[model samples]
Every structure is written in C-alpha cells, then in structure tokens.
Target: MKRVWIAVALLLAVLAGTLSHSFYLNSFTQELTGLLEAAEAKAEQNEWASAEELTQLAHHKWDEKTAYLHILLRHSETDEVYTSFREVAEFIQCQEGGEYSAANARLIAELELLAEAEQLNLKNIL
Candidate 1:
C-alpha cells in the first residue's frame, strides 16, 4: 500500500508538471505571435523602423525563454523557430514587404503549432 501511494504521488507530480508546461508554452507563443503580427502590420504601412523594432523585441523575448524552451521542447522544433526569426529579421531589414509578410506568417504559424503540439489532449496521448 505504501509503495502504491508513492507511485501515485509521482504520477500526479508528472501530470502537474506537464499541464504547467503546456500552459506556459501556450502563453509564450501567443505573446510572441502578437508581437510579430504587430510588426507585420507596421511593415504593411511602410513603417520599416517600427517594424524592425517590434521584430527585435519579439526576438529578444524568444531568446529570453531559450533555456526554458530548450529543456521542454525538441531542439529541432526550437531551431526552426530560430531560423524563422532570422529570416523575418532579414526581410524586415531589406524592407521587402512581401517577403517579410511571408516570413512573419511562417513564424507565427510555427509558434501556434508549437503551442498546439504541447497541449494536453486525448489526440496527443495516443
């Protein structure tokens, strides 16, 4: 009975950690997506400077979460996001609206997918 109780406690701990991580990842991705969207909007208006600033801010925020993300996420997934960020930054620097929008959209989609993948749902369990 004591061993069963110990096992139950450990299982509960793992569940709690998984749920917490899911919540954090969702929120973080949403925040980054919002920033990128705003930057994309600015670029649409030909506000290159503001767009660049917002992109940098979003990149900085992502970098700040690097260690935590690396721990809980596959490195390949995180690396894709990193590459997307670089592509967006380069496009913004060049003031190429079409390319910037495409890159920004890709980054946002990647973030959304990342969040979705981490969600604790029945589909994921199987």
Candidate 2:
C-alpha cells in the first residue's frame, strides 16, 4: 500500500542518516584522539611548545564542530569535553606533566566514549 511504502521510505532515510552521523563521529573522535596523544607524547619529551600547539589545534577543531555536536549530542556530554579541553590547556600552561597527562587521557577517553555512545548498536536501540 502507499502508506506502507511511505513508512519504509521514512525508516530507510532515518537509518541512512544515523549511519552517516555515526561514521562522521567515529572519524572525528579518532582525529581528536590522535592529536591529544601526539600532544601527550610531546609533553612527555618536555616539548611544551609543540604540545601546547597540538592541544590548541585539537581544541579549535572541536570548537568548529560544536554546533553540529550540540545538535546530535546532549549538551552535558559536549560541555564535559569543552571543560576537559580547558583543564588540559591550563595544565599545559603550568607545565604540569602529571596533571596534563591525566587530563589529556581523560579528554581522549571522553571523546571515544562519546562516539561509542552515538553508534547504532543494539544497546543504543534499546
């Protein structure tokens, strides 16, 4: 029937959109995580300037995606990452290696978890 076809079309559209968004989020998170890891490595080697630059680059990239992220993710989740970025920046400014490492690790973990949460998994569907 016409109604059945319409419903199938709508469902397919939704599925396509979800898959695309998940793919985008996964790639974005991976990119950010790489930047954070590189920054962490630089800091480990006492390359503070390079580390700071990398952190800033990652933060800027995240900021660029803020509006899109906010539309798809909960504000609290997005804000947590924003706050983590600030914490990492502060730790970098103070040259606190231990603190910076911890904060960077946390930020990376958060990004990964955020992407995982958005995947079209059975857990998510339920």
Global local distance difference test of model 1:
0.95
The lDDT, on a scale of 0 to 1, for candidate 2 is 0.97
Compute each candidate's TM-score over C-alphas.
0.98, 0.98
- Model 2's TM-score against the true structure: 0.98
Residue runs of model 1 more than 4 Å from their true location after superposition: none
For residues 12-79, write the lDDT of model 2, one tens digit per residue. 99999999999999999999999999999999999999999999999999999999999999999999
- Tell how far residue 65 is off in model 2, in angstroms: 0.8
* Model 2 residue 105 distance off true place after TM-score fit, in angstroms: 0.4
**Residue 59 miss distance in model 2 (angstroms):** 0.4
Tens-place lDDT digits, model 1, residues 13-104 = 99999999999999999999999999988999999999999999999999999999999899999999999999999998898889889889
Residue 53 in candidate 2 has what lDDT? 98
| Overall lDDT per candidate, in order of appearance | 0.95, 0.97
